[model samples]
Target: MARNRFDIDENLESPFDIKHFRRAMIYIRRQKKPMIVAFLLSALSAAIALSAPLILQHVVDVTIPEKAVGPLFGWSALMLATIVVSVVLATIRSRIMTRVGQDIIFEIRSDLFKHLQQLPFKYYDDRPQGKILIRVVNYVNSVSDVLSNGIINFILEMLNLIFIAAFMFAVDVRLSLITLAGLPVFLGIMLMIKTRQRRAWQAVSNKSSNLNAYLQESISGIGVTQIFSREKRNEGIFTRLAANFRKEWMRALRFNALIPFSVDNLATIVSALIFLVGLLALGPGEATFGVILAMSSYAARFWQPILNLSNLYNSFINAVAYLERIFETLDEPVTVSDVPNAKELPPVKGHVRFDDVTFAYDPGHNILEHLSFDVKAGESIALVGPTGAGKTTVVNLISRFYNLTGGQILVDGHDISQMTLKSLRSQMGIMLQDSFIFSGTIMDNIRYGRLDATEEEVIAAAKTVCADEFIREFEQGYQTEVNERGSKLSQGQRQLISFARTLLADPRILILDEATSSIDAKTERLLQQGLNELLKGRTSFIIAHRLSTVKNCDRIMYVSDKGIAESGSHDELIARRGLYYRLYTAQKMEA
Candidate 1:
């Protein structure tokens, strides 16, 4: 009644859950035809191997004793043929099983990646990237061999044991019983060791996950570490993580080594006992050399399968630990899936409405409460707010990145929740402060906005945002390779490239959250002319800290405490002398 190491109270199910095993079997079922062929080949190989002792018995007792040269030659040839047949069958079976394993790995990895893409943003927000990567990459690789080679090999070994046991009993039950006297002791030892071995392996897997997470975090933030002169401190942390991993790994290694060592010593002792019993039980007419030789061979064969089974069990335990992690990820609920009967959003005129909408990242702590507002088509509105006033949250709501806690958000009279996410978000263009540039050519990064855009179109879009002049100045021009996150480019240049990319998408609704904050005053003035022309017919929401950015906006709204504190044109708000006026005056004085 001892609790399993893997079981947790929250699971409410056994660690070795039937559902998880059944799901794994679904992947195996895909290659059922090849698996059946491999099974038959394994059986044939085992049968051929089982024939070796019988042929040796015949040669020792009959052919050699009679001095029959013809029969001796024939028996030798038959023995050689059995060896050849066993080798051929084993080789073919191995190839087939390898293919089946690789196929299952491909399918599982593909499905995991596709599922990750479909999962909502909140799912990623709650999990570390390193932990997710370990499940997707390392866990899948660990289970591959067990699915392909472990199960099939274990079955074949069991078949060999059964066949050897049957042959031993047929020859003489008394000797067979004597040869297997050590088996009960061996089984008891194995049972005692298995739980400890499993626990050690599980510890190893957990430590490996932690090591991977730390490495990923440190490498990705190496810049910050270097700038802060914390290289030695970070190295110390890494050494500690590595030491913990090595400690658990050594424990697992000891457990794995003990099984084989015990089995080998037991086999030798058992063989010696079988030989002694054979010698004592033999009489002039009662027993022949053939019987003694055959039983000796069977005793050796018997322990070989047990040894193989032990090793396979060790591997299975380790694999199951990783399998549990993988299945846990696969079972994560997608909380933001589309409605069952959701329809695609048609062409939109860009009118957005928030009616009594309330939202929170967690329960009982609202970020936006009963926020009601409407933006007219083709209007440019600027959101000016103090820090943490939820300006970004409003932009996220407009794009349906998170579901509202209460009420509804609508675009062109259709509730966004009732529309397919793809159809709803495709027509919206967003440009943020930290524009992420993928590792690719400048042209490739820009072309990502519209995958099928022609070269001329890409050039035109860059020109519209004044990104073309600097791009052409580079030696590689449009083909200039950008390092990860545009590390080689200045902040202003990265922002311009992002602008060019979003401009190429030609979205009807645009969201710019401090998009030009990195641009110098002269550059900002130059880009402002192009932006004014681009915003002429599009509905745009701009979140800005600078008063100059909102001065040209049709209306400016001051956001505070999850509600609009003031709303009007820049001039109108200045005349009203409220929160907006005070904020603008402070910025003016700082400038």
Candidate 2:
């Protein structure tokens, strides 16, 4: 066998820098009409607030002399209308913003979950499960919060700023300019806060992941802690991690909270400055009492948006960091997908060949090297080896669960990688060392072997594997609930159910990896009989931790610490009196 070679790409990068900002804007654009109306309503509300003094001026300086009630009633009605419109628009704006935030967050969560499942096995091996979960959660919440509030608040503030400036200029341009000039100083303070906040947020994220990892590992390994009597030690470590997380969270909140308060106070001080300037500019008869009152209101309004923009700036930076995290997950390149022009596997005659196969999970170690082997139609082979002798690795390559690093695995003489992954695996049956049963009825687990299999077919498959005997003893027989991962069943029974599942599929090739390692001698004997019947006309690979399980295979390969040290039939291999004979003698001696 020749070593199969292909390129590996390791430079992971985020999909795009701007994915989060665009997601936020999509909502704004979707509700553009309603948002525009809300902006106008907010603007009108500010305008009406400014108009109060103008109306007072008219009543005192012009209307009262005319003794007219008409102007007062008309101005009062206009003010009331603007207030009502603003309230309605504000309500609509809140509802739309909430909808946008939830929808975008939902999209992110769904895609992230799908990506996590699609990632190759090696990815999971390298990353902590708890940390990965925390990243997903933190990114979703941070992005959603910043996006929803930032867009609506920033837009409304800008509109409010525009109206207030217009009103102030109409009444007293000089005072308005003096008040507005002070805003740049507030912006400078916000910029400094933003810089600190970014570092604080990063610390928050790091600590959150660490805390979650600690909690998850402790809970999952509580059995080990109990056995070792290390419960107190584990709890103390967890408490310390949680405390550190709290410290990081508070530090971030302190910075996050300080930016807004400082901006608000600056806006207030600028308003006071405007009041001082207004007093001097509006000396006797130059401006009415009404004009001075209205100028002050406009001056205060002008500073509000500056404060808002400052808050929005801080939010935007944090949201962008979260967006970057989200895009990073989505952007991970799928390494083991089918070739662009891959075709479906044709009907099989059950022949498998490993031609010059060498593989390594990492660049540093070659787990399989030049392992050339063949399985002809209707032949059964056993793989016997100590841990890491590549028993499972050879079978994994044939199943195409992981692409080869340096070899060609063929099914019916066609390169397995050139076939669609679905097509290649559909023709094979696998019973792993650790079986998984979804939460469903016993019949459903068996039916998973072939979705379209009939009820009678399911029963037949179960009977063939000798599972029907105990299955019928259950309260509901085949319909009995398996519970999650078949926890409701005994280990031997779970093994029996998996056997029935594989039988129901009628696969052309079967790979059993330590399939009966957990069953007692009586159950193992029954399973062995059932397996011989099951493999009658198929090419099969069987891995057994116990040598007794390999007695009937036509050819058995003794995979030793070095490599294949011996290969022959049960009788012939025993005659050789080599590694296989010694292992057989040891098992008998123990028994």
User: Could you say which candidate leads in lDDT?
Assistant: 1
User: Please, what is the whole-model Cα lDDT of each candidate in the order they appear?
Assistant: 0.87, 0.75
Worst 10 residues of 1 by lDDT: 1-10
Tell me the alpha-carbon RMSD of every candidate: 3.6, 5.1
| lDDT by residue for model 1 (282-331), tens | 55555576888898889889989999999888888898888887877777
Local lDDT at 149 for model 1 = 81
Q: Which lDDT tens digits does candidate 2 get at residues 1-591? A: 011100111122443245556655764575566555645655555555556556655666676778778886886787677667666756775676677667667767887899987787666666656766765787687777566657667776887777677777887777667767877776676667766787676666666667776676676667689999998887788787778779978988887788668766766776676666656655676766566666666666666676677667767766665566666667666777789999989989899988888788878687887778788988999998678888888788888878787778888899988999888888999998887788999999999969999999998988877789999999999999878778788888898888889878889999999888777788777767777887999999999878888888989987764346678898998998988888889989998
Q: How well does candidate 2 match the true structure, expressed as C-alpha RMSD? A: 5.1
Cα RMSD for predicted model 1: 3.6
The 10-residue segment of model 2 with minimum total lDDT is: 1-10
Model number with the top TM-score = 1
Could you tell me the TM-score of candidate 2? 0.87
